[model samples]
Target chain A: MAEILARTVEVTRKYGDVTALDQVSLDIRAGEVVGLLGPNGAGKSTLVNLFAGLRKPTSGRVELLGGSPTDPARRRGIGVTPQETGLPPTLRVGECADFVAAHFPDPVGRGELLDRFGLGDLAKRQIGGLSGGQKRRLAVALAFIGRPRLVFLDEPTTGLDVEARRTLWDGIRRFHAEGGTVVLTSHYLEEIEALAERVVVIGGGRVLTDDTMDAVRGLVGIRRVTLTASGLPELTGVLGVEQEGTRTHLLTADSDALVRELVLSGAPFADLEIRPTSLEEAFLTITGRESQAA
Target chain B: MSLVLTHARYQFLETVRVPIAVIGSAFFPAMAMLFFVVPFAGDNAVASTYATGSMVIFAVMSACLFTYGIGVAEDRAQPWDPYLRTLPAGPVPRFTGRIITVMGLTLIAIIPVLVIAAVLTEATVTVPQLLLGLGAILVGSLPFTLMGLSIGYTFSSKAAIVIAQVVFFPTAVGGGLLTGDPAYAPEFIKIVSPYLPTRGAVELVWAATTDFTPNPLALIMLAVWVVVFAALAVWAYRRDEGRRFT
Candidate 1:
């Protein structure tokens, strides 16, 4: 098992009357890409902020590199790119990179870092004149400049185009391939699927599920069976049912059992199709159940 | 030390690239020299010398207040500030960096006033007097710097700008910067002037450059203001840090 690089032990953080995180505990291990999948206002950013030392837990504790997150020495081993950031408008891209790099003990070369993010050609451009996507890429690139063992990126590719997002993902992948640990939060399920080996789903300031990608898939394991039918009797093994005009759709964890029941019931149906549901449907199911329970 | 310089260099670059920000602090003092001093007191060696000292203080006060106060507040308003705070260098390097940047800008701001005094007015000083006057300007700027830092850390950028402006004119007037010398100004100003930090600042410059006697009361008050403002600045900074980052 990999060593734990960062951890939040029963951490609870509040902003006056609102609780951003409630007894949320998580561990990020070395050389693993962990995805924090949550909807907006679900304490994803708050968790990242605590680990990055930008905020303190109202209770419990946050540790980074085996020490208190607030300590400067421990902070040096980690890097973070927040959801929103503004660079010095008048500064050139190269200068901005240098400024952040100077804070770290061993920083990556400026040109190499820029090239990794596809920003090599923009070294001389002032941040104010760069396109929004370009500025975002630069901001994310700076996080890697420090050569940190652990990196936390909160919504790293928000507001970026598909091409720009891919470029950023490649950069992140390269870092992970080099044995770097990463914890990134994103609502984009595909982003999590593409990068994360471990998945931690959060909702309503609580962890709905924490498991490997394959294990989480098995947990949801829902399959959608659609057919054109009328007045169909309710079937066993069905978790949910939806009617669209003459077509009926059934959601079930066991598609084989549901199919067997459907055939035995002698339901008059046509165009019968059964397929595995996407992760989107599973996430909705998990989060929806959480909200209802709360 | 290198970290401090790196932070200072970048911060200086950030501000100097915007030419208007540089010109804003120097405008009023240079204009005052032109409109009031050059036309009226330009020929009187003693009066012109005293007026020059007051305007230099005026320049220093504005530069310190606006540069540190509004600049810091505006930086806090940006997402970049929070990001920078998260870095591992702690606050000392950044704070020292900002002070260095402000000192450089302050020197730039006083140039226009100095040029006007040297060229159009009868303001004369030996080399030693000039050097001492420069040292006095640096010393005089301390209280304003602390006051500006307090306002900056305590308020948002919008409120900070208004507060700095509101504080600017009253100190200039009450300290007798615009009245040539407090002893010759209205009786009310004479009584109040010694208590203003600006009065102590200008008096130091006057004593440094001319035969004028420095007021013991004004100097004492200046020291008091520095201590008080230092405490307030620290409180404001700690309060802001606790509220935002814990």
Candidate 2:
């Protein structure tokens, strides 16, 4: 197994009466892309903060690179781009990059970093003059400036357009391709699909599932079985049911088994259609189940 | 040392890029010289020389207080500061760099007053005396710098602005900076000046530039203020860090 770069051992964090993370344990190893997927307030940012040494866990331990997260020497091995940031608006892009670079022992060259993020031409411009998308690209690009072993990005592409988001992703991918570890949080499932090999689903400050991408997709393998039928008896293995006039839609995990049962029941169905559910609907199904269970 | 210098250069560049920041620090003291010293005491060698010393201290006080107090508070409110804090290098280098930048701006701020005195007023000093006075001004500005840092770390930028203003004017007036000579100062000021840090700071400036003897009580009080403000500044810093990060 790759060396464990960062770990939280049954960590819990709270803000007064609100619990941000609840007895959560996770390990980030070298040379892997881990995606933290959740809704708005599901402790993703809290976990990132703990690992980055920005905040301490209320209970339990957080270790980064085999030492305390708050130690400066240990923190030198990791880079982080918070969900929101404000760079010095008056400084030129190259100047801001150089200022941050001087703090590291070995930093990426400003020119190479700018070009990698597709921001080569904006080097001379003041940050105040850049568009919001351009500024966000710069913010994410700064995380790679120190050539850190591990990078934590909290919603790295929150306010970016499609083209800009892709540019940012390419920069991140180049780093990971060079054997760097990445842990990113995003509500955009497509982003996780495009980038992460491993996914951790978080809800209500607890880890719901942690598995490989294919496994997660297979686990929530919900299919929409729609048919034009009426006066049918209750169906087996249907997780959810919806109706639109003469058509009935049944959400089922095993479409093959549901179809066989329907045929055996002799429901006299016509125009039978079975389509795979999009990842978005499947994710909603999981979270919806979680909320109902809670 | 190189890292500290780099931080100082960037911080200085960041401040100077906004022309108004430097201009604001230079404006009040220069204006005070023009209105108070040049017209009224320009012909009197002794009066103009003493007023020039007071205005130089005034410039240093303004530069240290506003730059450290308001500048630091404003920086705290920004995301850039927290990001910088997360870096491996400790806060010492950045803190030293910011102080150096403020000292540079303070030197720049005193220039207009010196120029106005040299050209229009009868203020004069030998080369060694002038250098000594410059050194004294930097040393004397420490108390105000610490005071500024305390307010900065303890309050938001909005509140720091009002607090700095409230703290500045009385110290300037009550310390006898407005009076042309300490002997000619109001009776109330004479009694109160020894306790204000500004009095000791200006007295050191006067002693450096002229044959005047600084009051021992004022110098002792100045040292006390430095210690007091230093303690307060450190407490404020740790309090802020605990509340925000821990």
Candidate 3:
């Protein structure tokens, strides 16, 4: 019910004979972290392009901040990082950051931004001299330069190392905690699991499911509860029961409730392990797009 | 103004980082002056003066066409241009900034030729003519600038390079730039030079710096080229935008 920062009203975008986006509609509200999960060619980038005012829908309307996405005034409050970006190789990192910063009315200071992205040491180095990961860090860093209310990051940590990915995650977390809405797309399920509270599964240019993180995970994966119990009569009637040598395994959608029932029944159990479903398992099941992207 | 200047400054920094780019633009004109003008017409005040103006126009034409045509096409392939285009500010400021940067390079490109003409040749011009020639140089460079933008937006970088080279040499030669004297020009050149934009551009520069009378027909043709290039530039921009983004 919060103010809608951006929305697509049955927007359809086409390129020649192919329809990149169908009559898909979505709304991104203020102060929300939404994850767009999909494989390659799922129209995730196409949809983000519409939100960022980079493209126009062929038929239905695309709106941003209560105006057309193409409007310059509305873009003042939005930030975006595309999937594949090649920074100007000759400009030094600090100079590049400052150049982008100058476009906004109230941009973050160059020095502070450098420090935040761990790019301080590379400040004087030309972008061409930096490693691929360093260049990606700079690209993502530019998105936050304008102190925007909403951000659209398309595969932000694609080429980053684990260490750099963690650092960027920290920055994203800090930004979100400071009341900035984030809309991110990623191939890595862990990335979505780490950041997004709401998940939208997109496949074939359609929204398959849009729900809370827990609910989406519940769809494709059945949580497994393993325990070693002696004389466990109550567990006999449970669904998906597999009896190992001295241990019992129960796979169910509601692991929390099953555990609580066991505890309330005064069953003697040792080493109870409740493992929630992994995002990868859920993604493959819900979208059935395993061969498309990493 | 500040934003445009910032764009210009950054663009300048980006290009100057590659020293060869600066060297390349200045090389041809200086070489033309040294080999063609200084040796043959250095002693003749009238011939050297007109040749000097023609070289200046030559430098301007190369700087605007190759720099914008190839540079814009190459930049279009990069991610930075799209990011900039999607910003809150429109492309006008950036376009103007790029033009200023290219003009700055054009001015620098002409300097070596000018210096060679002054030191080696007897090119004579009054103070008023000198200032007028500078003004004329900038104005005459307009059609070429637009032409560069048109070619750049219309083709890919590799294609742009080929297209620019294909169109450049013949136009320059057919326009009678290297022929020196009108009466001595090839029969084919004399017939076609009045219609080419380069002929009008170099004609204006010659009239500004020497005692040469401006050709009315060439001036009118030059105006027509300006309108044509302007229209092409606009068409290229809209087509590029609609094709890429929409």
Which candidate's DockQ is highest? Answer: 1
Which residue pairs collide, candidate 1?
none
Give one digit per residue, the lDDT tens place, for model 3 in A25-83: 99898888999987678788889888877777888999888898788888989987733
- Interface RMSD value for candidate 1, one decimal? 1.6
How do the residues B1-246 of candidate 2 rate in per-residue lDDT, one tens digit apiece? 888998999999999999998999999999999999999999988888899999998888888888898888998888777777667776678877988888899999999999999999888988998999999999899999999999999998999999999999999989989888888989999999999999999999899999999999999999999999999988897667624532
List model 2 lDDT by residue over A219-243, tens digit each.
Answer: 6679999999866777788877789
> Model 3 Cα RMSD, Å?
7.5
Per-prediction interface RMSD in Å: 1.6, 2.0, 1.7
Cα TM-score of candidate 2:
0.86
lDDT of 1 by residue, B27-144 (tens): 9789989999999889988889999999999888888888888989988878888788778887778877988888888888899999999999988999999999999998998999
Q: List the residue pairs that clash in candidate 2.
A: none
Calculate DockQ per candidate and list them.
Answer: 0.51, 0.41, 0.40
* Deviation (Å) of B138 in candidate 3: 1.1
- Residue A40's lDDT in candidate 3: 73
Comparing 1 and 3 on DockQ, the stronger one: 1
Q: State in Å the error of residue B149, model 2.
A: 1.8
Worst 10 residues of 1 chain A by lDDT: A78-87
| Residue ranges of candidate 1 with Cα displaced over 4 Å | A82-85, A159-164, A218-285, A291-294, B242-246
lDDT digits (tens) for residues A40-97 of candidate 1: 7777877888888778889999999999877878988988773345788999999999
